[model samples]
Target: MQKPLTDFPTGSVVRIAGIDGGRQARSRMLAMGMTPGCPVTVLAGGPTGCRVRVRGSEVVLCCGLAGKIMAVADDSDEGPRCNCCPGPRARAI
Candidate 1:
């Protein structure tokens, strides 16, 4: 089963399952390279907000916005690679 974005703690690597939001919100997130199947790293988070690295870019999302992003925690040893921005090696910190 997938978990909400907020459920992942800092330093967790996860794969996006889907986003639950209106057209505008979805479009904005998609435009920022937050598409399904991409790997993201949770950098830091509070009760209602968090910062994540997506496709080598930092994105800040509030709890309301984050709850809309569903992801499955990924612990594979394979290096992280976002389809949107491939080539760079990603190692868990």
Candidate 2:
């Protein structure tokens, strides 16, 4: 099942299921490559915001902004893996 991006734990590898927001917000995220089906790893988060690695790049988003992005948790033991990078960087969420 899909849940708000914030619902997932840090280091979880999740696939973007969908997004919720107005045109501008959605466009911004999409343009930044946070589109549906993309795999993102939650790096760190707090009450207000979090940092995520998207498409091998790290990006930060506020809780409100993150709430708009929905994701399906992946079953892989390791966290998100950036194909562009090397080494076993994945961690348990």
lDDT of each: 0.76, 0.73
Residue 83, model 1, lDDT:
55
Error of 1 at 66 (Å): 0.8
Pick the TM-score winner.
Answer: 1
Name the best candidate (by lDDT): 1
> Model 1 segments beyond 4 Å from truth?
76-93
lDDT of 2 by residue, 1-93 (tens): 767888888778787777889998899899888776567789986557779988778899998889888777755433233344334442222
Candidate 1 lDDT, tens digit per residue, 1-93?
687889889988887778888998789878988787678889996569779998778999989888888777655433233555434443322
Clashing pairs in 1: none
Measured over all alpha carbons after superposition, the RMSD of each candidate to the real structure, in angstroms, is 3.9, 5.1
TM-score, candidate 2, is 0.76
Once model 1 is optimally superposed onto the true structure by TM-score, how far is the C-alpha of residue 70 displaced, in angstroms? 0.5
Model 2 lDDT on a 0 to 1 scale? 0.73
